[model samples]
Target: MSARRPYTVRFRTPDNNTLENCFYATDAFQARLLAMEFNRYIKDHPNRIDKIFSAAQR
Candidate 1:
């Protein structure tokens, strides 16, 4: 068995806004994988990205 670690997924808007969404992981590789997946998800969904930033108050 291995020890667990903490990780954070940061979602940033084009205008420099950021959101910290964290999770627990078992290793650095897992954390990096999660970040990549989240990034890919956002990239694949343009409308969602627009909506997320547009809905935010500037």
Candidate 2:
């Protein structure tokens, strides 16, 4: 397996509150996939993810 690094997921809640979360992943694409799966399990909002990026980028 590859080493993981910090990544950020930016999303908006149903209430319009923008939030960001940090996760560790091998790459940006994996980070995005992780966020999508996480969003699916959220009870209040299943489509909250707006974008994913390497922490270094934004």
Candidate of highest lDDT: 2
When summed lDDT is taken over every stretch of 10 residues in candidate 2, the lowest stretch is 38-47
User: Which regions in candidate 2 have their CA more than 4 angstroms from the true location?
Assistant: 36-46
Provide TM-scores for the models.
Answer: 0.45, 0.67
Q: For model 1, how does the per-residue alpha-carbon lDDT over 8-35 read when each residue is reduced to its tens digit?
A: 5556566657655454566645655555
What TM-score, to 2 decimals, does candidate 2 have?
Answer: 0.67
Single out the weakest 10-residue window by summed lDDT for candidate 1: 49-58
Put down candidate 2 lDDT per residue, 1-58, tens digits, no spaces: 9999999988887688888777799997787777766755332553677777887887
